[model samples]
Target: MRISDIPVPDTTAARGALALATEYQTPALTAHALRSWLWAEAFALVDGVTGVDRELLYVSAVLHDIGTVTEFDNHSLSYEHAGGHVGIALTAGAGWARERRHRVLDVIVRHNWPSVDPSMDAEGHLLETATALDISGSRPGDLPEVFVREVLAAHPRGALAAEFGACVVDQASRKPDTAARRLVDGGVVAKLAANPLELL
Candidate 1:
């Protein structure tokens, strides 16, 4: 796996999140998670976003999509909520305090939100914006084009657009009132297909 120049935050909690994602998530999903973290870091730097809990954001990045994977998929709950629960369990295993664990859960769940206020939760804001960039190429100009190509070269999209889209469509089919449904109704799958990042 070629890694980009971006230095992923390495901490015990971050490592744990990576391990869990690698073990349980599909390769496409894993790469998306990793890229999400990279995008989060890059966005933070470019936007002068400071004082964020880097480890928390990284952990949320890697764990954010695991719920969509087969083993962790919750039939009833939306993928983000299920993933949030998984994040809480994983962080609790790492001995995080209640507040920290809650933060992980909130970040994971809110990453799918329409928008997150940076002032209220910097980590959530970063994760939400980061995922948007990766999944739909939102705010593409925020990071340098060269840096984006470097990241894509390291963690190629593979079948992420197809894989994630199919999973989300299925989720929407089953859970009509979820964010997944909203995303589907809102043409998210089409946006994924046409994501400029993939074209790059």
Candidate 2:
């Protein structure tokens, strides 16, 4: 479903998400863009795997990290609670169907357990990989080769995580040259300051 058609989460939930992102030191712009793109990607994958509604899946993915904004330590539990909160708020505001709400919660809850759960769907797998990649930065010197060679190479989830992490870092930096510059400058401050929109 189109993003426009999806109902926005409540003000409190949105603020909570932003707060959690700040606490986690999530780059504001990156998180905003990443959430949108990630949801779109997750929806596509989920739709392909299950006959579930893409819009519902997108909603779940977009708000999955809300509890992270709170004090939730376990991502899986945080996601589940966040999903419930969003679902309840959406139901009240948009009059969503019970089945659709359940679907959204199921997807959100499964998203944080890709590595440990064999029953994860494509959307869940994609979300897990994308989140891992974001947490593991992609700058030139930031690439953990040992993780790739020794850890991820044997695991599908791990390997995909590394690949997506690299791609996200590359995309975030604009180019390999930019990555080199970022490494030299000690961070992406200069490059990003020069081209703010590039990050989005």
Give the alpha-carbon lDDT of every model.
0.88, 0.42
TM-score of 1: 0.95
Flag regions of model 2 displaced more than 4 Å: 1-33, 39-52, 71-79, 116-122, 136-200
Model 2 agreement with the true structure over 1-200: per-residue lDDT tens digits: 33334344455434443343445523442254234334335334433545434455445555555433334323333334554565456544555667656655665555545242324454454454444344323221222344333222222222222332343344334433422223324443333333222222
Clashes in model 2: which pairs? 20-69
Query: Candidate 1 regions off by >4 Å?
Result: 1-6
Ten residues in sequence with the least summed lDDT for candidate 2: 150-159
lDDT measured at residue 101 in model 1 versus the true structure, 0 to 100: 93
The ten-residue window of minimal lDDT in model 1 covers 1-10
lDDT for residue 158 in candidate 1, whole number 0-100: 95
**Which clashing pairs does model 1 show?**
none
